[model samples]
Target: MVGYALALALPNGKFDIAHAARTPGDPVRRRPRGNALRKPAGILVVREADMDELGWYPNVETPEAR
Candidate 1:
């Protein structure tokens, strides 16, 4: 399973992962359908063990979803 992490640029000038979600695959690679954020940047803070079990990259989406 792959997961998602959100980083928010706030007034306080601090970066944080707001949300996390998981999907089946290495990662969910998706392009915005319309005019959304040009590119979303963030980080994956999950444990290495978790990734080993899931065997996912992070944000790589599948062919059907694309």
Candidate 2:
């Protein structure tokens, strides 16, 4: 199964991923509609192995091979 790591930027200059959830396909479309009332989140598609934890990856150039 496919999964994602989702996190939102907080006003205190930190990220919040306490609400980690699973969604299919487009990450943007998967976000809750009420998210507009909160900080926008950052999403990255990940494999099942990577789903064990919640984390953030910023400005990553993700190619199958780096």
Candidate 3:
């Protein structure tokens, strides 16, 4: 699983990975070069009980008409 692989890649095997699924890197292919998912920008993670709440909503501004 992606989560398990990520855990092994971290420096101390401890992390608060929020958005670790957006990455498209193939771990099997990039593992040789120490490919690990890094924290993404503008992302948040909330943990509740037995399940985690994950969301990836992006905010893009629309240009006003000239």
lDDT of 3 by residue, 1-66 (tens): 245444454552123343333334442443422322333332333222322353336744448422
The top-ranked prediction according to TM-score is 2
lDDT of 1 by residue, 1-66 (tens): 222323333222223332223323423332121113222353333222345566456868899669
Query: If the candidates were sorted by their lDDT against the true structure, best first, what order would they fall in?
Result: 2, 3, 1
Best by lDDT: 2
TM-scores for all predictions: 0.18, 0.22, 0.19
The digit string of per-residue lDDT tens for model 2 on 1-66 reads 122333433332233332324444444563453243234474333222335464457646659538
| Best of the two (2, 3) by lDDT | 2
- RMSD for each model, in Å, please? 13.1, 12.6, 12.4
Error of 3 at 58 (Å): 35
